[model samples]
Target: MAIKTKNISPDGKRQMTMQQFTAWLGRFDADKDGKISRQELADAVRGAGGRFAWWKCRQGLRSADSDGSGYIDANEIGNLVEFAQKHLGVKIVGF
Candidate 1:
């Protein structure tokens, strides 16, 4: 089951569109495996000017890896998206 993420803005409107999330995934799915690995996520975070903490990455994987796959797949993508938004506080535009 996909975890639900509340993307509503202050006015309770959708803040991010699906296309934006898909584009975000494409930025980190370097192998095109439909999943974001720890290294890929770390690289993406670092590339975004965020501190790359190995421990935090592991924690993130644990938080987002709903299926115990050690990677963030489509089902858990919401968690990763929320993590980046909360932690990095950057508007991730297309690459």
Candidate 2:
């Protein structure tokens, strides 16, 4: 059987899959607590060739966090991608 995938880009272009996003989030969880802290998110953003100021990173983390938790999870990472896509007009394919 052939498997189907969903595209997240605005132009219907194929982008990173959910599994890939989750894997990337796993890599970002430096402390391996199944959650990503603001510092970890900032480091990951910087490492991914994106410039992030301390305050901006903190705000991003707060915005991406949906559950009101202090940390972000894999799902939150997906939301972060969408947020960046909307605000920055950049397509984040993966980590």
- Which candidate number has the best lDDT? 1
Q: After superposition, how far is residue 26 of candidate 1 from its true place, in Å?
A: 1.5
lDDT of 1 by residue, 15-94 (tens): 45555755655677889988889987776666555665576577678778989988888878766766765544433333
TM-score of 1: 0.67
TM-scores, each model vs. reference: 0.67, 0.63
Best by TM-score: 1
| 91: Cα error in model 1, Å | 6.2
**lDDT of model 2 at residue 69?**
88
- Clashing pairs in model 1? none
